[model samples]
Every structure is written in C-alpha cells, then in structure tokens.
Target: MNEKRRFRQRLKDFDLTLPESKKEYNRMLFTPVAQVYSGITRVLSFGRDAAWKRKLISLLPEIPEPRILDLACGPGDLSFLLALRYPSARIEGIDLNTDMLDRAASNLARMPGNIQERIHFFPGDMNELPFNDGEFDIVSGGYALRNSPDLGRSLAEVHRMLKPGGYAAFLDFSRSSRKHTGRLQLGLLSFWGRLWGRVYHGNPEVYGYIAESLKSFPDQAEFLRLLEGFGFSPVHYLPRMFGMLRITVIRKN
Candidate 1:
C-alpha cells in the first residue's frame, strides 16, 4: 500500500479521534522536522501567516514593563518576534513539547545579550499554567487554541494568568460560519497541506490533519462567544488569506 493509504488505515484501525488525531499529527509535524514547521506554515498559508502574526502583535495594548507569555509557542516564532519588538518586555514561552523548546533555546542563543536575557522557554501546560494568578501583562499564543483539548479550560487559564486589563492575542486557522464556504476553503487548504507533506515531508497524510482539526474546531463566531464567556472583553479579530486564517485579540476586564 502507498504510505498515505497506510496512514489512513492505521488511523482507522486504531480508531483515532479528533483531539487525539490533532495531537498525533502535531507530534509528527514536530518530530521528523522541528525547524521546518515555520517554513511550511508560511508556505501553506500562502505567505500570509506572518502578516496574521503581525496583526496580532499590533493589537497588543501598551502596558508598563509588559510581562508576556507565549503559550504553545511552537519553535518560538511569535515569541521571537515579541522579543525583537519589545526589548524591555520580559517574554516567557511555554510549550508541552521539549524538542520545540530546545529549538527555541537554540534560536534564542543567537540573539544579542539583552534579548537573550529577556526571552526564555520552559516546559508548561496551557490548561494549568504553573504561574500564580495575574502573572502576565500580555498572553499570546499562535495556533494553540484549536488544538487545545478543552478550549474553555485553556481560555480560563489564560484569563487567570493575565492581570486585569491585560491582553491575550492569538493567530490561528479560522473558518466561515457558512457551511459551503467553510467546506470549500478547508478543501483547498487540505489539498495544499497534503501536497506539502507529499513533497517535503514524504508523508502526505500528516498535513491532512489540518482539515480534520479545522472541521472539529469552533467557528469564528463560536470562538468569539468563548472568549466573552471567559471574561475577555473588547474582543476583536482580523482575518487574512480571505478568512483562511485569523488573529483574535481579547482583553481582561
């Protein structure tokens, strides 16, 4: 059997599920290749992924001596960006995956002395962050919520960590509320994801996980409600790639 078919068969045989599927695929994405994840992400998003991140960064409200946390910060892409832009900010990046953190540390090693001191990474869970309540001035995560096993619990942790009036922003894959439009966009994304996997990853089924995760994740409006229920006010969002991706900015009130 071809590798793609075999991959599908294995998932079928094991009866793998949504968040589980997401978890497995994410591990695979990071396992075989850690550094290339960002490159492939930018490519698959048609080069607009960085733009979405920039939008999220721009939404960050000015706060005195901001203490920032980048949750599920895969390879510290956004975290690095934060360090570059906010020299005075203390940035802590947390993720469950050690290899990603290792790579993040390596990247941090290359920076000048002050930046290296300001940005750091450690192992932590987003659902139960280790810090005390109201620890951060801003919390930003890229593409983490969609993969979160419990979005409500994760958002709660985010809210708990932020000082009142702190901002939390995230960039992630988003979908249309309309079923047909959602389907079409996901189809195109899945096709591209699989193609990237086949060409660069030698595992076409790996990136197909994107489509599956999107289908299982909350839509734009639903997620906005989730933020509000979590006690995040002044919630706002921006879409890019014609709604293929989004940046949601929320603040604790």
Candidate 2:
C-alpha cells in the first residue's frame, strides 16, 4: 500500500486510550507532515500560533542563564523562541517523533553559532524523560500536554524535572467540563482540523486526531487541579480565542 493508505489504516486501528498506541500513532501522524507542521499550525490557528507562543514566552519571568526544557518540541518553535528571549540560557528540546527532531535540528543548523550551540533537540517521551530530578529551571511545552499519551504521568515528569521555584508554561486547546459545550468544541475542532488535513495530506484523520485526543483531556479547571496535585502552583492563565486556546504558567513548589 502507499503511504497515505497506510497512515489511514494505522489511524483507524490505533486506540488513543492506550499510551503506547497513542505514542506510535502520533509518530505515524506527524512524520509525513513535519515539513509543513509550522505552516499548518499557523493556518489552523488563524495566524495566531506564533503570537500565542510569544505570549507564552512573555509570561515567563527572566532568569539568568537558566536551563530550559521544551517538551514535545515539534520543529522547535518554542525552543527557538526561548533561546532568543534568553540568550544565555541552555535550551534542550525533546520529542517522540524523530522526523520532527530532524526538522528542529535542520532549523538549528541555519542559526548563528551561539544559538546553534545552546539549543539541542533529542528523541524522547515526555512521560519518561531522561533527566535528573530538578534539572531544569524552566520548562515550556507548546501544544504538548493535550497530546501526551498519559497526561498525569507527563505532568508528574514535568514536576520531577523542574527545580524548586522554577516555572513551566503550556499552550494548548482548552476543553470545557460541560458535556454539551465540550462536544461543540470538539466537533468544531474536528471539522476544521480534518478540512486542513484533507487539504494538506489527503487524509482527514491526520488532523482529526487533535479533537480525538482532546476528548480524553481534562478541562481547564481539572487541568489546574492536576497541576496543583503534581506540586505545581498556577501562576498565570491566559485564555485566547474565546477560551478555546489557553496559555497556562505554573511554578514548581
């Protein structure tokens, strides 16, 4: 079979509730589209993806030579932004998909020597990061949490990776607790996402995964509770696009 057929078959067979399956599905979904991931994000978000990321970075407090971690750093957009905002900081980006990592690496190569030296990308899972406890001063994840195969485990890992008083910020689609409202949100997201997926990849399921994943993700309030339960204190919450998207900053306590 051809690549598109294989992708559709895998998407149909994979179960999002299973962590390993979700991880593998994500790899299959993104690998073929890594080159256009950023562009698609801009289109999907109505040209606000970059602005949302910039707002996320602005929420972070300045730290001198801080060590930063960008989890699920697809194409290293947030990682590069953090590097530019904090020139002396060392930024490490980790993602499950190697194709995305390759794109990030390619982007890094074109940068000047100083940024190229400070930023590095690697292949890894967020739920089981290969780093020491309290290793990072700041951790940022753009559209990361909602995509995690195991959100609680991933949040626990984020808590474990951060130093005391360190901050972590995440930008992602927000869900509502109310069933009807959530269904409306998911339906709209799925329709728009699948439209783009069909246009770009000739497969609606390619981007429809976003809505499917969000179906299992916690709503805003529950998300905040999860963060607090994982030893993080919510510091800033910025809702954009009528609460459909949010940038949340929390501090490690």
Candidate 3:
C-alpha cells in the first residue's frame, strides 16, 4: 500500500483513537514526520495557505484589542500573523507537537526583536485546553480541526475558551463526496497535493491523508449542526473551491 493509505489504515485501525491522556495523544499524532510534513508544506504550498489564514483572522471584532489563541499552530505561522496584524493583541500558539513549537520558537526568535514579544508558544492539547474560562477573544485553527479525534469535543473546548461575543474561526476540509462537486474537487486537490508531496519530500503520506480524511469527514451541514449543538450562534461557513475547503465562523453567546 502507498504511504498515505498505510497511514489512513493505521488511523482507521485505531479508529484514530486518541489516548485518554492528552500527553499520549500528543506523542503519537505530533510525531517528527507530522511536524516536518507541516513545516515543509508551509513553504512548498507557495504561501497560499496564509491567505486562507488571513481570511479567518479577519473575522475578529476591532473595538477592544483581543486576546487570540491559535490551536495546533504548527510552525507558528498563524500566531505570527495574528501578532503582526494586531500588534497590541495578546497571542498564543498552542499545539501538541513539541517539534512544531520548537520550530515556532525559532521562527519567532528570528523575527525582529520587537515582533517576538507579542507571541507565546506552548505545548497544549486541544481536547483539554489549559486555559481559564472565557479567556480568548478569538480562537482559530488551520487544517487542524478535522484531525481532532472528536470534532464535537474539540469544538466544545473551543467554545469553553471563548468569552461571550468572542469568535471562533476555523478552516478544514469538509467531506464533499456526496455531490459530483466534492469528488471532482477532491481529485484535483489530491493530484496537486501528491505531486507537490513527491517533488518536495517524496512522501505521499501527506497528500493521501488529505484525500482520505476529506472522504471520511462529516458533511458541511452536519458540521454546522455540530457547531450549533456546541452553543455557537451566528454560524457561517464559506465553502471554497466547490466545497473541497471550508472556513467556519461562529460566535459564542
């Protein structure tokens, strides 16, 4: 089997089951391979992902300088962007991947000294975030939501972290296989991802994971329902590229 399929089978065989302990889950999913795969893609993807991230970050309110939390901030790109955009905002980059946190710290250290102060990096578990209630004005994640073992539980944690009127903006692939729309888009994404994968790292695992995960994802409507069940209101989703990608924004009451 191809590397991607192998990884999928591994996840499926385990049912993508995370350990009851957050620490163990972190050790498994955030392995060295995952970190390298993510870090390289940040560059190999020609930086288009930043634009998607920017779109998500733009959803926050402007009245007060908001404290932002970036979940699974591999390599710290999103955290850095938030700090750059809202210079006065308090920003934290939290992830299970220590390697990614290390890279993020290196990235931050390399920045001009002034920009480094606005960002904080820490090893964190999304299922059980280590922050107080109603702490963040905005919480965002990129390509990270779908990887959660329990999407609903992850969303619940996000909700618990936000203060009333705070916003949660997230991006992830949605299962689009229902219509010809989803399949065509998935095929194109798979082709490009695999091509890039081979050229950059020759490990098809990354591309294959994208395809398999999207195939296994909940439909957009179901995802919306999940969000609502978490007590988020004003839920809105923008389906990109014929539903292959999605950005969801919801506000906590």
Candidate 4:
C-alpha cells in the first residue's frame, strides 16, 4: 500500500479522524521513539508548547479545586502541570496509547511523591470516556481534538463528562491568516518530524499524515460552532504563534 493508504488504514483501525488521534494512531507509529519525536517537535516549536499549555491553565475557570480531565494526555505534560497548578484538585490523564500511557505514568512517577499523588493517567477512548456524567469541572485536550474520530462526538463526550458550568480548553493547529508563517512552520515541522521518525525507528507515515490532516483541519469559525452545538456557551478562541495554532475555551451551560 502507498503512504496515504497505509495511513488511512491505520486511522480507520484506530478510529482516528482528520485532526488525527495520536492515541489511536499506531504504536509502531511511535513506540520507544515517542520520547524522541516529542523532543524533536518541542525543539522545533522552540520550546513553546509547554508554555502555551501553562498559559491555558492560567486562564482556566476560577473554581476551588476544579476536577480537570486531560484527554489524549500523551506523556502527561498537561495533566502533570494541572496537578501542580491545582494541587488540591483531582486531575486525570487519559489516552488510548498504552505505550504513551506507560511513558506518562513513568514521568509522573518521577515527580515529587506529593505531586504524583494528585494526578492519574489511564487508557481511555475520547469518544466514550469511562467517567460518569458531569464528573469533571474541566476537560482539556492538547493537540488531541483534531484527530478525534468525530469532533462533535468528542466535544459532546467532553461536555457530558463535565459538571454543569464546567469549562474546556482545546489547543491544536490552525490555518492562520499569516499564510507565510504557517507554511514555513509547517514545512519545518514536516521535515523534522519525518526525519526524526526515521531516526528513532518510528513510522514516517504518521508525519506525512499529520501534514495532510493539518491541511484539512477545520477553521476557527467552524470549530467554534461545533462547540456551540454541543451546548458549550461563552466560547472563545485565541490564535497563537502567528496563527499557526489556536486554543479554544468553551463553558458548559
């Protein structure tokens, strides 16, 4: 099979949609190379990813001990940060990738014991989360929303998992008005992702598929409406890094 066909097959196998679910994405697509690929992508972003997540956390709703859910919590960065940000709150990290979950668990384990106690990482499918209805005060995704098998379904799932009046933060790539910057950033990202995937014995198909997926991702207005359709009110978005990425926040009514 060709690269596209293979990637499509993998996506179908894992139930990933256009934005591309890293969790359902092939284990061979990552594996031991997961850490290396993450490192390379972080370097390519000039270390902006974590800072962006931090900023999003800072903007979270002012609730005492909000229960936060990190969907597709690859490597547990957002979940770990939330744990530290709200030490008294409950935080859960869920991903479909067992290997990635293992890595997340390992990273969490190395943290100071107290911090580790505040966070939990488990395998979860975004389309049908395990938690009961209205269990979380906040639900967040880091670059995971795009790959959801059904964006609307995923949003509904997040909404259902949140308590009434709960809020959510979804950060992912976007088609920025600054076309030149977006193109350059994407080109550099593709090059490094593919190169390093090969270097670390990862699936190069994933890199190419990501480029294609980004090209086909929904624009800001469409995404906002999707959130609104899921009963999210007070929806807002902040385009970041010259519009190459964006973070959308929606409050559940």
Best by lDDT: 2
Q: Could you tell which candidate, 2 or 4, scores higher by lDDT?
A: 2
Q: What lDDT score belongs to each candidate, Candidate 1 first?
A: 0.80, 0.91, 0.73, 0.74
RMSD from true fold, candidate 1: 2.5
TM-score quality measure for candidate 4? 0.82
The TM-scores, one per candidate, come to 0.90, 0.97, 0.82, 0.82
Candidate 4 residue-wise lDDT, 1-253, digit = tens: 8864565456456534433444445444545445664675575467898888888888885788888899888898888878777878888898777888888988988999887888888877798888899999989898887766666778889888899899898878776545676577677657765765455444554555565557556666676666778898855678787776787888998
Off by over 4 Å in 1: 1-25
Which window of ten consecutive residues has the lowest lDDT sum in model 2? 174-183
Off by over 4 Å in 2: none
The lDDT of model 2 is: 0.91
2 against 4, candidate with superior TM-score: 2
Clashes of each: 0, 0, 0, 3
- Mind giving the per-residue lDDT tens digits that candidate 2 earns over 76-160? 9999999999999999999989999999999999988999999989998999999999999999999898888899899989989
The alpha-carbon deviation from the true structure for residue 197 of candidate 2, after best TM-score superposition, in angstroms, is 0.7
Error of 3 at 229 (Å): 1.3
For residue 55, model 1's alpha carbon misses the true position, in angstroms, by 2.2
Give the Cα error of residue 115 in candidate 4, in Å: 1.7
TM-score of 2: 0.97
